[model samples]
Target: MLAVLVSLLPLVRVLPGCHCQSTNATAAITATTVTSVVSGSLTSKVGGYAVFDCPVPLEYVTRRSRPLVIRWTKNGHTVFTLSGGSLTTDERYEGRTSIVEPPEFSDAIATSINVSSLRESDTGDYECFATHKNRDLQLTASSQRPPLPSSQPLSHQSSTASTLSAVGTDIVDAGVRIKLDVQGGDIMSIPPINQTRLEHESVHFSCVKEDLESTVQWYKDGVPLDDLPILNGRFNVSLEGSLDIYDAGLNDNGFYLCRIMSAKGTFSAGAFLNVQYKAKIVYSPAEVFLAFGKPGTLDCHFHSNPPLTKIRWEKDGFLFDTYNVPGVYHKLNGSLYFNRVGKEHSGKYTCTPFNDLGTEGPSTPMDLIVQHPPKLIVVPKVLYFRKLGDNITMPCEAENVDNKSPAIVWQKADGKSLFDPRVTVAGGNLTLTGVKSEDRGVYRCVASNIAATISAETELIVEESLFHQKNFGLHINSTKKNIVAYWKRPYSFCTVWSRDTSLKLSNWNATATSSDGKAILWNLNASKEYEIMVSCREEISGESLFSKSILIHPKVAESDQLSLQELNKSTGPVTDSFDIRVERSGGNYNVSWTFTDNSRKDQADVERYQVKWYDAFDGKELGTASTEANKRHIGR
Candidate 1:
């Protein structure tokens, strides 16, 4: 009789028709895997028959699937076996037990068995397992591609029922417990003796009592022997009637019982097996970056079943005991304390933690890098010679002292802020454009990092090399009909140029007859494009220095010329000129000059538009269209 009545629901997996490795594919879909467990208690009266129906193990045996082997075991001994259509029954179970279904499609029902003429003798644990034959051949036949050689060997040793199967073959079993209480049953003792052992050792639980038969079986923690985590072949029922477990493991420790059938009745007893193991780490030291002369700490923590007795530390593979080293001490809370971190303390470190039971791991080592300020590798130059308007740059390079890079800036050594438009610093380099005398000073490249800030300075002197100067640049202001050009006092023989002048070069192009740096071209032509530039020399006979060329497009009418108002305001060059206008009457046009400021009025009256451009504008002296476009192209 049972303590209470409970309704049990049967949920089974629907499998496909026969294929060699169909069950292996089901392993991925169904939860009724190798480790699936089922446990229940059964009772039978004296001199009567008992029938046990196992929970359905879906698709465990499919007709036409493969060569199959089935076994029904009590304790670790086979009570009945069916292999590839061949059936064998253990001597004591031969006529007493019979299968509930036909042997062919045992797939429709779980491993169900019946026993007749039940005596008090049949009390123990029973397991149902199915094994497939031709393992390698079955896996090979199901391959879509050639199998690759495994780098690491496959493992069959596991600590849980879920991991009991590997490639090629699978072991499926059901959990069952049977108890027959005829007489002398309640005589077993309380709090049975303990069978304690270390990991990986062998253990035995004897069921021998002089008059008992060899049909005895074993149970562990109320689970059938085959359902224990050790499972399969490692669990054996010896001929002398003892439960033998090989290569005992931590998970194997549990309450074990031995049940025997004697001439009088059933005898059973149990004992607890205690297993001991080592400790494991939970947290340890990590990479740390601490400035020199600062306090810091490293940590280590662990856990274990038996608890750890000691902790070890290693630095670059050598013992690192904080108590043995100066300026450092070990803390009671399992941390290393540093009085002041120094360069010598920077290196890879690892923590090895262990308890009395055992030790876990610190797979990777951590690093400690000491921090310090950056240092300059090379200093900037003391003197640099640059033309008054040319650009200049200074260099400053630095190297990391303790694996930390520094932030850099460009500044004046005299603590002056760097607000000049021409000054910019990048990667410790300083640059200045349009160099002038007032721009001269002691400039510095400053570097700062977490540790400290430092700087390097150099005195720079700017000189007016040759006759080149920033103010010497050309400026043009013109209308559609007239063009006036003027320059400063320091230069002489200022010559005007045009792209048309290059084509008839070597001949008619003559220098302007003016001694002062001033000239005017009064063309009275508003509908033409002009390409112009200026060249001047320190003396009339000196080599001419050229300025950037200018383009006056038709309809623009000095729009660009008025845009230079700010630049002209700063240079303050000579400002005297004349303008020319054209008046048209019935297809005839009149050209006239109007002088402004009157500073160069005498030169304008003599240079009239009719005497200079009468034949040129009419195209008599110009070349073909291709020649004109090619000669005046801006980049040319």
Candidate 2:
């Protein structure tokens, strides 16, 4: 019987914590033989459907005393059961799980169940039970009778035992078991691929899927955005896979991702958010004042994300261009450059910055005031000649005066202010009244305004009046036997004449006049006494001057008839005056004398003279000297 029980057993498979065993009854006869088998393990993605099969042989339930009962259990918990044609399911498996009937062409009476929307908790061992009531059957000698002999009957019995042994090795009569494995689910779609929100606006994003049991998560720029202290009140995510943002700012702009996770799989979707606003003019133009012929610049500053594409410059409410003006241009940093500013460059200027989002308003109008320095129009002469007690004037003029009228004044060449009562300035003209010799210096005319100062100089020369002198003296050369006289005249080209009182009218002599105030009388007779008169008259002014009438006597040469005592005693001529001069020459006294004759002639006969030296403080005669020349050297 044990052999028969072993032979009647069906094939059994080994699983984790699952075993199949069979035992035989001690009774000599049995009523029913049942074999149960389990199908292969089934696997499905999480949030998907899975089916478990239980194979039960039809012969085991045929002709049973009671109807069959089918039950499915997972991990020792009842999942679903069908008894007396009535189906029942566990509370957790309700509506989502169902039992399936076996097909008629299948050899086994099978019980199957489908689990929909599988989750991680549904992955475990599943058991199917098909139970039927047992009935008793008796075997006797008459039941063993057959159409064959007794020996043939034994062979038939052996064949039946072999068939039962094969069933016992492969099948199990306990129950059917099925293993289930749940995998992660997949994400279907995510709405709102990208979002763009203005400042202070709200935005929403959703991650959708078919599986209701899937878990949703949110991320920003690849980082998880959940329960972060920085985004505590700004960001939110719903259970239905929705992300909401409120009062979005520039910091909130970035790449956003929505992730869905389940037992089937993990999936995510990404989007980008961009924030935009209008540009603003951060720095406006300011007023600029520049000097003429100098360079200047004006800047127009602004702030924007896309940057400015163009900048327009305006002057005096009109567009400014380099085509019309030569020294104007634009700088790379959105500034206007004036290479050389002039009077025309003085105006109101504005700058406007433009970008793709349009331009900001024009900058504040800046006043560009150009000022010029003072320039001289009429210059003064370099030199001016004026007589004494005469009036003189120097003219000067200037242009490009500022609001304040230019101050004109005259100054001396020594940089001192001219404060004399004779100096006056009017209308840039410098005049001097009653010019004197003291005014004979360089005089400058200066013009000054708020902008600049300029000056010009002129030199003044004062000349004195001319005059003539009377009572002229004559000079006689006794050695040359000639008489020479010199006189002064008020003008050039004067006539000079001399006449002798003892001579006849035809004896009067006249010579050519001298332009430089000089005259000479030559070749006079010696040893004769006469009264002479000298006179001069200007050629142009007809003014005449005459010297006093005087008697002149000439001296004769010495002869052998005259003795030394006679020569000394004779009153041939007398000197009116004489001059004695002394000079030291290398430890020697050189004495010289010049004498004027009272008779206006030479004393040729007196060839030598005696000079006696005495001490002035005492009446002691120091020495006595004699020399034929007018000069002599006395040695110490």
* lDDT for predicted candidate 1 compared with the true structure: 0.50
- State each model's CA lDDT, in order: 0.50, 0.55
In TM-score terms, candidate 2 sits at: 0.24
Candidate 1 wrongly placed segments (more than 4 Å) = 1-192, 209-222, 239-241, 258-268, 277-306, 322-347, 353-636
RMSD of each: 24.8, 42.4
Per-candidate TM-scores read 0.24, 0.24
lDDT of 2 by residue, 1-636 (tens): 222232221222111121122344111211122132223333433333444433445444332434666677778988787655466888765545554444445433334455443455566877666665532211111212111111111110111111111122234445555466554424533333456676678887655564778887777767788645556688777766778888876667786766687767775545566655445467664666565776777677776545677787898899988668898888877777889878888889887788776765887888877766567788787555567888988888777454545677777865666787888778888888998867766677787754456788766645341122355553222221334444545555443444455555533344324555553332244344544444454344333444554555654456522543364357443222344555556656677877655533445666786766543224256787888888878776
Window of ten residues with lowest summed lDDT in model 1: 152-161
Give the range where candidate 2 is weakest over 10 consecutive residues by summed lDDT: 148-157
Among all candidates shown, the one with the greatest lDDT: 2
Residue-level lDDT of model 1, residues 1-636, one tens digit each, is 111121221111111110111121222212122222222333323223333433323344345554655566777787777565555787765444555443442344323344543334555655555555533111111112211111110011111111111122222233332332222323221112346676667776544444434256678877888776566677787665566778776667777766666565665555566666665566544666666777877666655456456667788888898768999887765567889889999888887767665576652577877787678887686444455787888898788766667888887655667787888777778888888866765677888876567888665544332224325455555654345555654564565654443343321122232346555554323344556555555343233455555666555436645754554455332122334444433444444444455535344333222222232223243221222110111110
